[model samples]
Target: MAEAPSWFGEVERAAWDRFRAEIPWLTEADRVLVEVASTLRARLATDPAMSVNAIAQLRMCLSAMGATPADRSRVDIPQNDDDPLTCYFN
Candidate 1:
């Protein structure tokens, strides 16, 4: 298993949980980020010349997903007060 990016902090994690509870499609970006990272980690660990471009793509995707320099990236999944995820899923 690959280690999660060092950048993902408490705020990011909470944001993801919030996203999952609200807009379901937004979770795809998170999942894709992890999947791509895992693949890159494997290749980068073993192969040389694995093209920095791939890493750049990951960072771009991260930024598109609202990552910040502070590692406090948040997805901003707004939930209604009566949201099901905040209630039963808890």
Candidate 2:
């Protein structure tokens, strides 16, 4: 286990709040999702080159937290691109 990133707590919480506020239909518990996402993100930051399968698994966890591809909610994804990715609201 490694230390949680200094930015993760703030970034994750902000995303969670925005998601819940916008979707209002994510019946999944907040703590659970955040914890899971934190683990994946920490892993990503440490060694993003981790197996494609592993990366996909983490992606699945993240995708599960939001809407489908059609609904885009503007968000700051930090590292994916220079700009923040738009998260679609399900």
* Per-model TM-score on C-alpha atoms: 0.36, 0.43
lDDT of 2: 0.54
Clash pairs for candidate 2? 67-90, 71-88, 73-87
Q: What's the TM for model 1?
A: 0.36
Clashing pairs in 1: none
- For residues 12-79, what per-residue lDDT tens digits would candidate 1 score against the true structure? 54444543443343444367564454455455545677788976775665565455444334556444
User: Where does the lowest 10-residue lDDT sum fall in candidate 2?
Assistant: 75-84
Q: What is the lDDT of every predicted structure here?
A: 0.51, 0.54
Q: How far off is residue 43 in model 2, in Å?
A: 0.7
